[model samples]
Structure formats: C-alpha cells, structure tokens
Target: MNVAAVLSCALLLAIWGLPWSDWLGHFPAHMIRHMGLVAVVAPLIVLGFPRLADPLALSPLAGAVLEFLVVWGFHLPVLHEAAMASSVVFIIEQALFLIVGLVVWAGCLRTGGLAGAGGLLLTSMHMTLLGALLTLSPRVIYALDHAGALQEQQLGGMLMLAIGTPIYLIAGLWLVARSLEDTKDEMA
Candidate 1:
C-alpha cells in the first residue's frame, strides 16, 4: 500500500523478467529468484496487502509449517525435475512459493512479538539446513538441463544461505527487539 511496498512489487516483476529470468536453465539464478520471492518480495507484498492474509487467520506456527512444506517439497528431486521440464509445473511451483511466502510473512507481521520472532527464526534454521545440505552434497541433487551441474547447485545453495539466512535472521531479531520495546513501554 505504501511506496516501499509498491516498489517491492515492481522489483518482483523485474526479477521475473530480463537477464535474471532463466530460472529453468540456471540453478543459481533459480535460487536467487526463489530467495527473492520468499524472503524479499513476499514480506513487502504482505506489508502492502495486510488484509490479504487476514482472512486465513493463520498462526505464525501454522504459517511457518505450511511454508516449510511447500519450499522443501518443491525441492525434492522428482518435483524439481518436473518443474524444470514443464512450464506449467514451473508456474505452479512459483505461484505456491509466492502464496505460502505471503502467508508466513503475514503471520509474522500480524503477530509481531516473540511468537513472530520464533516463527521467523525457525524458518531461518530450516533454510540454513537445506542450504548446507545442497552446498555440501558430493553429487548434484537436482538434475539440471545445463552444464556445470554440481558447481551450479553448490552456488545455488550458497546463494540461499547468503540471501535467505541474513534476511530472516535480521527480521527475526528486529521483531524480538520490537516486542521487548513494547513490553518495556507498557511497564513504564
């Protein structure tokens, strides 16, 4: 609804277009897009459209679990392969990412206390674990339709670790601080 949220929507559109749009062909690029969707763009959209998720009435814990399943399930070899092979599947996968991401972010924003921090911290932990798994795997986990599969996969993992971790960690910490501040103010 605000300027920042509007700009975030534009950024989301830009990410899906142009040179960064080869998600099916480049593993690292795909990871970048994934991180942008779940971490960056989703939060902003929730800010702009807070009521969009109000109807769901999801708790932070429920939202986190739903998001975790959607993200990790799509990364499974079979599902990943299917998405890579078909445009329709890819679209479906991306749409789910955006939707679940919106849900998680909305839950966090609406809760905005220790509970929200916990949800975000949990998400950060799982994302780190997945990134580490992909980064340290001896062989390629997902069969890519391009060259340098192993290297690209590793880069993708690194990208997730680099991008997703810090954003979630910082946001979680920010929420914790805000919660404490509110409590202190109430006590005063």
Candidate 2:
C-alpha cells in the first residue's frame, strides 16, 4: 500500500508539478492539479505509511490552518499571476501543497488516528466554501493565460466540491468507523 501510494504521488507530481504545468497554464488545471495532490495523494501516503508522522511533528489544527492559508494564499490573483510568470513561485506552490497534505494527515494520525473527525470535517468544509465562492462568483476572478477565466474558475470550484469534499468526508467516516471498532474490541 505504501509503495502504491508513493507511486501514485510520483505519477501525479510528474504530471502536475513539472513542465506539463507550464504547458497547461489555465487556472483550473493548476487548481485541480494541486487539489489532486493534497486531497488524494497525501491521505493515501500517510494512511499507508503511518511512520511518516515522526518527521513532521504537526498537530491537526496547525496542519489544517497551514493548509488553508497556503491554499487560499496561492489562489489570490496577484500571487497566482506571479506564479504563472515565474518558475520559482510555482515550485514553491507545489512543494507547499505536498507538505501541507502530509502535515494534515500526520496531525490526524498522531493525535487520534481516524478519530480525528473534527480535523477531517474542517478540511472538507474549507474546500466546500472555497469552491462555492469561486463557482458562485458573479464575475471572473482570475487572470489566466486562457480566454475563459470565469469558466476555469468555475471548474476549479467544482473540482474542489466534487473531488476534495468527498475524499475528506470518506476518510473521516472511515476513521470514525475504525475507532468505534477498536473501542468495541477493547470493551470485549
């Protein structure tokens, strides 16, 4: 499982974090790429290899906060545009996405394992609200290399809602079920 998770992350980064990212240039593509890495890859790796927690001594709350700030900070038009023009910010952005993902999962695993329902829920809600804001906006929000800025932003919003939200919800519920099972076993 750990190897599979690592491979999955490697494949995703190769597609999104490398030259293809420059080739794609559209905001939604970038947003989906980042979301896919954090929401999908991070949880898979952490759950597969819990030993990863030792290196990143992070709390669930701090992890969530850091993830939230990094995600939103990057979405800001100025910074987003800067990343588009420069390679350095793009690299930094991708690194932060991976690190924040690991930190969030580590936070959950360290404190209560799957019993960290609140942290997971917080992550879900954060993605939902961000997506909703983008999707429901009356005007175009981003300056992209492509023509359909509004459409791209809307798609990005949908990806967050459709993809990110479900992943966190499932993970949280899975954790809750595991904790309950463990409790019953102990009682028995």
Candidate 3:
C-alpha cells in the first residue's frame, strides 16, 4: 500500500526474525500468542489503510479520553508485564494499539486539506512517544529475565522514535502550510 504501511510491515518481519524470537519462546504460551497478535496484525492494519482525519472529530473530552487510553493503557506496568508474560495479553495490547492508531489516524484525516501532512506528523509523534516509553523503561517490564535481547529491543524502539518523530512533524507542518497557502490563493 502506502510507504508507511510498507515500512511498518518490513519492520515487523525483521523483528519476528530477530534474536528476541528466542526469548519470546521462554515467555508463557499466552504471552507468545498475544505477541503474535500485536506483532503480526497491528502493523498490517496501521500500514494497510491511510488514516482519515474525521474519526478523530470527537468532542474535546472524548478525544482526550481516547488519546489517554491509547497512549497510556498498554504501557501501564501491570498490563505491560502481563502482555510480556502471556500471549493472550500481548494480543490484547496489540489490538488496543490497532484501535488507537486507527482513531488517531482518523482524527488526522478529518483535518481536511492538510490531512496528509498533518496526520502523518501527529501519528509520528504518538508513535515516537509510545516507542520511547516501551524502549526506555529502566527495569525489564516485559521479558522479566531476558536482559540481552530486551536491551536491544529497547534500543531499537528508542531509535525508531527518535528518528521517526522529526520526520513526522516536518512532513505534517509542510502539509498544513501547503493547505493554508492553497486556501489563501483561493481567497485572493
């Protein structure tokens, strides 16, 4: 589909093949199951369709609630730990991510003329922050004992966020500006 979706899928494939897969083997069966759910399916959905902004058009309060749940829900320590410990939890977490991502993407899309650029940028910010939290936890929240691959996963997560954030912001601003200019010209 689009470049974003393509890249996400590629990344997911790479993660699946990495050394961490071995550690995942150690996790309880339920956790492994959930990991597959999130790791395999969530990205496909996000990258599969371009997000439309209108879905994000809830009242301010509702929007805030949605954002809160999306960003903080899975990251909660207990939830995170459970997900890492069991496959079922992991699947649930990924499902949450997919749902939240969809909502966020829709919000971006509804922004109208600047949908492309702005939506991408906001999504990037959301993703980067989420990744950072996942990667930067001081203690091993997920794979309690697997330090080696966990460390690597953390680093990779951080790198993705650090690199992706600016790119999204810049692209979003450019699209918004371009849309504004178009509007101005129309008025002129």
Candidate 4:
C-alpha cells in the first residue's frame, strides 16, 4: 500500500528466498530468519506508516483471512515441509507469506479496528503456539530436520516464538489503543 509496506514485503520475500538461492544452506535458520523479518521487523515498520492505517476500510474479511493464513499455515506440518523442500516449495511458501504479510500489514497500518486487532492477536497466538510446539518436540520437525540443521532448527523455532509473540502482543495492544483513541475522538 505504501513504500514501507512494499519494502516490508520485499524484505520478507528476500528472506524466504535465501534458502532456495543457496545463499543460506540451512532451512531452519532461513525459516527462523524469515519469521523474524516478517513477524517482528515488518510489523513495526508497518505500524509507523500512516498510509496503512485503514486496511479494513479497503477489505475487512480478506485482510483478516490473510493474517490467519500466514500464522496458522506456517505451523502446519505439510506447509512447513513444503517450504523447506525445494525451489518450487519455496516459491509457494513465499507467495503465501507475502499475501499474509500484506494482510497483516494492511490491518496494522490501515484502519485500526477490531478486525485488525483480531488478526494481530491470532498471528501472535499462532506464533507462540508454534514456538511451544518446537520446544516440546522430541526431535526437530521433518522440514528443519531434513535440512540437516537440527540444532539450529530447534533454536530457530524457539527464537521465533520468543521474539514473535512479544512483537505481536505489543502491536496488538497498539492497535487496540489506536482503536479506542479513534472511538474517543469520534465520540468527542
């Protein structure tokens, strides 16, 4: 929607592409880095941009669905495995990430509303659950384990949740605050 949002999406793509490009050999590390770039850095940047302030004003349900897809889809064993497999899988995964990122970014930057808050909360919860799942796993999941970087994969998953949840929560709260402020301003 704006330069910042565009850049955020670009950056996310780049991160997702690293493993496939062979710029990064470790899939788990790449995934972790990608998640960090998207879930953490991207949101903060989008939150600062005024142009993204009313995503719901554009397409409410679409934006919410995208957010859900990004967070929940990444956690699924099938999707995660596909993402770590090959170039084709990487492309699909990145595409999904981009769509999801746009939705979440739109929600955060555009009309700060209940839908925006719900999307942010959902993403945060999913990321937290993902981290917990990784930590609890007896062995690294197929995707990361197959990448031959089990230790890094496990660490990455833990780090994603550790870093991602806080970012999501803070952003969620900020969205909530903005929503309330808007309501108060409207009432006044």
How do all models score by TM-score?
0.93, 0.85, 0.57, 0.69
Q: Which regions in candidate 3 have their CA more than 4 angstroms from the true location?
A: 1-65, 113-143
Q: Give the Å shift of residue 136 in candidate 1.
A: 1.2
Error of 1 at 128 (Å): 0.9
lDDT of 1 by residue, 1-188 (tens): 68757977797887677466354347777787788899988888877766665764468799889989999998999998898789999999888988888878888878989999998998999989999998999998987655678888898999999999999999999999999999999999
lDDT of 3: 0.53
Better of 1 and 4 by TM-score: 1
- Candidate 2 stretches with Cα past 4 Å from truth are 17-25, 48-50, 113-115
Question: In order, how many clashes per candidate?
Answer: 1, 0, 20, 9
Off by over 4 Å in 1: 21-25
- lDDT string for model 4 (127-172, tens) is 6777777766777665543445666556657777777788778877
What count of clashes does model 3 give?
A: 20
Weakest ten-residue segment in model 4 by summed lDDT: 51-60
Better of 1 and 3 by TM-score: 1
Best by lDDT: 1
For all candidates in order, the CA lDDT equals: 0.85, 0.77, 0.53, 0.63
Residue 139 shift from truth in candidate 4, angstroms: 2.2
Model 2: how far is 2 from its true place, Å?
Answer: 4.1
